[model samples]
Target: MDISIREGILTPDTFAGLRAACGMPELETALVGRAIESSLFTLSAVNGSRTVGMVRVVGDGAFVFLIYDLLVVPLWRRRGIGSRLVEEAVSRAKLFVPPGRAVVVSLFSAEGREGFYSRLGFTELPAAGLGAGMQCFYL
Candidate 1:
């Protein structure tokens, strides 16, 4: 398959397809649609005319960067697309942070995927990051 990565908002038709492909829970389209327009960085992998994979990075453009919505279609899952999406996000993160304190990149992965991220060089934070926050509510 010929896969090309493009930068743009996720189209409405591809929204459900992409969400299901990535195994993400359903979200309101309007909310997601609004985000697509405001996203600072987004990469989509397309095969011919089909969107096969995608990932987005949403943040304040300076202090905080969060990785979100990474999903490769089920048919394309094991072909290193997921990791490529992550690599792209990391590369974008580099563009956001300068040489001073530290850039914090965080995400909440699904149940069995923590090991997958650890394999990708993400580790459990003992402190100073994930450990520094207190949650009021979770959905």
Candidate 2:
């Protein structure tokens, strides 16, 4: 099978479908479109005309980059598509850093998926001289 990765070509429908295929709840179409348009970068993997995977980078475009919504359809998991998406996002993040300075590229890994990101060099926070990462969601 051939997979092509394209940047900044995701539609809300495709994004929602990919999210659903990955067992995530549906998001509002307007919100998804707004998020995509506002993201630092967005990448989608296409198998012909269907979107099989997607990943996005969100941040202030210099100091911090957070990998968000990394998802690959169930049928495409275990095939490295997700890894490739992350690699592309990381590459973009590096470009945002200015010379003689550093930028943080981080993500909140889905539970039980630490190995996936760790293999790509992401470390668990608060474990290597860093503070614990925290978040709060309003329900």
Clashing residue pairs in all predictions, respectively, total: 0, 0
TM-scores, one per candidate: 0.81, 0.93
Q: Which residue pairs come into collision in candidate 1?
A: none
What is the C-alpha local distance difference test score of each model? 0.77, 0.90
Predict model 2's lDDT versus the native: 0.90
RMSD of each: 2.8, 1.4
Candidate 1 structure quality by residue, lDDT tens digits, 1-139: 5777777846755877788766777788888778877777888888888889888888888877778788888888788878878877877787777866476677767668987788887775555554733338768
lDDT of 1 at 107: 72
Q: Give me the displacement of residue 127 in model 1, in angstroms.
A: 5.3
